[model samples]
Target chain A: MNIIVCVSQVPDTTTKIAVGADGKTIEKNGVKFILNPYDEYAIEEGLQLREKFGGTVTALTVGNDSSKDILRTALAMGADKAVLISDSGNSDTFGIAHSIAEYAKTVVPDLIILGRQSIDYDSFAMASMVGELLSLPSISMVSSWTINGSSITAERDIEGGKEVIEASLPCVISAQKGLNNPRYPKLPDIMKAKSKPIDAVTGASVPARVTTVSMELPQTQRRGIILNDSEHDITELVRLLHEDAKVI
Target chain B: MKIIVLLEPSGNSIKRSSLESITAARALGATSIHGFMYGGDANSAQIAGEYGLSDIAHTPATEYSSTAAATSLAQFAKSESASAIIVAANAAGKEIAPRVAVKLEAGYIPDCVGLALVNGLIQGTRPVYAGKARIAVSATTAMSVYALRPNVFTARKAENATSVNVRTFTPQLSESDTRVKVTNVIRNEGKLDVLEADIIVSGGRGLKGPENFHLVENLADKLSAAVGASRAVVDAGWRPHGEQVGQTGKTVSPNMYVACGISGAVQHLAGMSSSKVIVAINKDKEAPIFKVADYGIVGDVFDVLPVLSQKIGAVTGK
Candidate 1:
């Protein structure tokens, strides 16, 4: 089996989000970049699947030259090879997915995996778009997966409960959290990753479907108004909710 | 103007979140509201008419899937020259909206709690930083795409609605187009999941053991609320992944969110701070949850939960 996992380099989830001086875009001056956590789950799942099924796992990402560091990390995680879809700068989820899907057409892997969504942009739509662009069976919010001879089964969490679905081979799946406990890279593997081969592919020149005009911080909550000591304050609080807050 | 609202079928009926999107679309001066459904049964068209939609576009999928449905809808949106498209910010919408946005080169906004048209421009108020803050944004593109957050806008029944005009479109797709195949789906047997619940009762590390989650579950049953766990609780495996509410988990905006024995982590607060009424039951008076809570009881949850459940039961007859 040949398994291909798609990943993206995004701002670290722990990075402090700040608005630029123009108050419209995320401030990039001090932001640190890292691999999206969801992609980590995808990579780990791919590696485990490859280990069990005796196949090769290739980790793929689309970004500028700076994103090679994330690919290196994936290589250290037991992937056989890494592919970087290089671009001039960052691309929206659609552009990136389109390029990946076009590349997948040539590779024709048996299974494709990606995170349910990217943590930084959190668009959560790229995997589905890639599935649509390829006309492949797709599943989202997958918690568990098992592969049969020519079919695969996955567990998906819905609003009320879970749904068990089965599809044929050559399917695409976007994994959510808790699918598996992702393993960290060891010192030996990290050193071995230096010798791993990474191929750079130019991304597709698709017109950007959406453009972010500006990104501003959400309105901050005001400091809490402390109530004076008294049981009577409960009534005042309820009254404020009914009148001022209008949430009751 | 013609506004198309993409209605996803939930179970045997239409999701309530789609009605909220229709409400917002109407505010944008939609003369004719078109409801689009994929892999949906015949009742879906009728349900759309009940929601005040005048036209319904039905695209039955051979594969009975969301990807096929989205491809069909994207074609419909382009052919009809739709000025605006509205969808619910649920799993299906989250998957399909961006695909349509990319196909049509439309400006897409996700998790919009409210929408309005100001001076011929559509403005959306969406939550950021989990649910701690709401930011208003305007689309830079010509056609606007919006995904409405669930439970923010109440869905009202529209009386005397006319029958919908239905049309079917065959999706154009290739085998290579369908790369990511869904191999299987597993369902969990339980009560309401956190994302769909109207009220949620959540716990944290304050609970001594995983076995003690029954206490929280008991209160949840009393209020017909879903049970949720903070990251600490989830990491401990007290509950399944579906029950986790935080930055790394599912983002929820319920009507009433009750936190029991939880010390508010910034990540946890990001997921559920947008709840309409926040009630915190914690022994520590300085717990961060109290800062955002509408009502806080400083006491042991073991004692407070029983009394609170009784009070709520007496009022709600549950």
Candidate 2:
């Protein structure tokens, strides 16, 4: 079995993001970039599958030159190969999915895995889009997985429950939280991974189907009324919730 | 313009979120709103007429497959010459809508909180970078699809009763399209999911141990809300991962969010800052959760929780 994993780079969750002057993108200055949190699980799952199934795991990403940092991280985590599809990094989710599908067409790997959703856009649509483009089965938000010969069984999360899905080889699975604990690369492995080869190929350009009109910070108007846990305060809080806030 | 809304089945009726999608289509000034379902009959979907649906399309199916469903929906929309497709951004909708969009060569937008008609096109407002920021976006293609986030759009019943025309058709599906199948469904019995609950009671590390989680559950029971947890509590094996609310966990936007003993991290805030009302209870006055909370109580959870729960229970008569 051969496995392919998709990875992305995103801003650190703690970083304070600001809308750029163009009103369409984030301000990159002073923002710390790291491998997307969920993608770490995808890479880890790929490595574990390859370890058990006796196959090679290839890590793939579509972004500009700076995105190779995540590829290096994947290599450090024991991915056999890393490929960066060099593009302008301004395309929408469809364009990115199209690029990945185009690359997968050439490899025809037995399995493709990705994070459930990118934290940046939070579209949660890539696995389905790529599966459709490749005419393969797709399952999202999978928490547990098992493979027997050519058949695969996965337990995935739904809105209020879990679905036990069955599919065959050459399917797409999106890694959800609690899938597995990712392993950290050691110092020696990190140093060696920096020298690993990354194959960069030009990505085909596709026009964006969606365009951003404007961007702005969420306007919050919290009341910020603070009170102690005294009896009087608790009573007053109940009164406020009943009459003023009317939430109860 | 002809608009098609995907209706998800919940037992014998449609899901509330799917009804909300119909309301969204009505808000788009659609006079001809159609409801489509894969496994239900027209009689089961007659309630859609009360929510401004003029027509209903149904296809019977014994198995579940996302690709086959998308193919059927895309074909139905194209046959009806529909200009827009609306679906609730639930699990099944999130999986099916993108494939339907790709099949129709239409631009798609998911998890929209606001929608409007701008110059005969749909403009959507959605959160980016979690809920830290929001962006106004529009589809460039002639045909468009929008997935409204659950619990945001209010599903209002129409005043006048409108008759619905129901149609059934056989779908075009191949062997490959139905390969991925749902073998079984496991439901969390008698428990409300946090994603669909109007009110949520979430606990954090300050609860100390898993044994004390009864305090959180007791409060949640009084308010008839779902139980939630912070990443720390979930990671500590105090609660299941489905109840965790944070960056890597589930993002929730409830009408009221009550945080008990939680020190809000930026990642945690990103998941729930959009809530309509936020209440934080913590011993530390300087906990970051107070900054975003509409109401803050400074005290220990053990000291404050019982009294607060009793007072709320008395007020609500629960």
Candidate 3:
């Protein structure tokens, strides 16, 4: 059995997001980057699946030079190998999926796994698009998965409830939260990951359909009005909601 | 211009997000609004008509449950020469919209909150970074696809619009095309989903014990709101994972959000900060939630919740 997990590097969640001088892109200066938190779930799931089924877990990522750290993190997390699609050019979710699908055509993994969505853009489209591009069965927001020979069974969260779906092997799945608890790399594993082979590939073209004009922070709110007055408290609050905020 | 809105069947009726998409489609100067419904349900056709969609295209897709729906919709949109395609930002729509966009090679905007036509091109605003910022994007492609956020737009009755057209489309799907299969479905009993509720009452670690969740649920019942919990509460297993709202959990933008005993960590704030009206009830006066809240009640949640619930009940005689 062969499994591939897709990962991406993004600004750490703690970073104070700010617009660059161009006002269209994120300010990368003095910002720390890490493997997307959601993708860690995919890596862990892939490793566990490999351990149970006896297969190789290959982690893949699409980004520029800084993305190597993410691939290293995956290898450190117990993936057998890592592949990095090094293309600095901006690609939409569709383009990223196309690149991954194209790469998968070569490796032909039995299962392709990815996070439900990237934490940065949160487009939530990669896994589905990859499924469509590769013509593979795909499920999103999957909480639990079980494998029995060539057949796979999983539980997916819907709006109101969960859905039980069964599909054969060689499928694509975007893991949701609580699928499995991801483990941190031990000191020995971290040292071993440094020697693990990381294959770097390039020359992927992304069709551009949408252009981002500018990105800016939302307008700040006014200083909050503290209600120190005791007599007309709730009434003032309701009035503020109705008249001032007009939210009611 | 002909506009096509993909209607996803949510249980027995069309999803509310699809209705919002229709509202946006109409605002784009669409002369004719067509809705494509998979599985050929008559109730779905009727509901589409209520959303001002005059032409209804019904296609029965048994093998291709959700993904095939997108293929069929793309075919319909191409046949109709739709200028724009609109879809709901739900689970199915989230999967299908991008696929359709990629197949059509159209400019796709996911999770848009607002839309308008500018200089004959569709312009959309989407909240990014978990609602910390909004980005306005314009489509450079010939056809534009948009996934509108759920419950953002009210569904209005489209009077005297009864004409429905049902078209049969065979989607191209393969058995090997899907990588993941759903094996079981478990539904929670007796509470509305936090994402769908108009009013949400959420608790955090400050609530302490799992037994004390009744305090939050009791207030939620009185206010007719859904109950949610922070990541801490969910991680501690005090509440179900579905009810967890934070950066790592569900992103909710409700009309009214009530935070009880929640300290409002940045991760938690990212989920509900987009809510229209926020009310915070906490013992700590300096909790970050108060920064974004419209109303702040400085008191213990156990004390404030019951009092508020009783006062609301007495006011409404419930």
State in Å the error of residue A39, model 3.
1.1
lDDT of 2: 0.89
Please tell me which model should have the higher lDDT, number 1 or number 3.
3
What is the C-alpha lDDT profile of model 1 across B132-216, one tens digit per residue?
3345676667776788878887776576676877777666865443433333334455568898888899998888789888878
Which lDDT tens digits does candidate 2 get at residues B27-139? 88986888899875557787888987878888778888888889999999999999999998888999999999999889999989999989887999999896778998999
Lowest summed lDDT across 10 adjacent residues in model 2 chain A is found at: A234-243
Cα lDDT over the full model 3:
0.79
DockQ list for all candidates: 0.30, 0.80, 0.52
Q: Candidate 2 on A1-248: residue-level lDDT in tens?
A: 78999999988878899999899889989999899889988998999888888899999999988898999999999999999998886788899999999999999999999999888888999999999989999999999999999899999988788999999989998999888999999989899999999998788899989999999998779999899999889888778878889989
Worst 10 residues of 1 chain B by lDDT: B177-186
Docking class of 3: medium
Looking at candidate 1, what is the lDDT of residue A214? 50
Between prediction 2 and prediction 3, which has the larger DockQ? 2
Off by over 4 Å in 1: A194-197, A220-248, B10-12, B44-50, B60-63, B105-107, B118-144, B156-190
lDDT of 1 at A132: 61
> Can you write out model 3's per-residue Cα lDDT over B47-160, one digit (the tens) per residue?
666667777777775444556677778888898898889888877788788878877888888888788777877888887776666788888889989888777756666665
Q: Is candidate 2 or candidate 3 better by lDDT?
A: 2
User: What lDDT would each prediction earn against the true structure?
Assistant: 0.75, 0.89, 0.79
- Per-residue lDDT, model 1, residue B43, is 70
Poorly placed runs, candidate 2 (over 4 Å): none
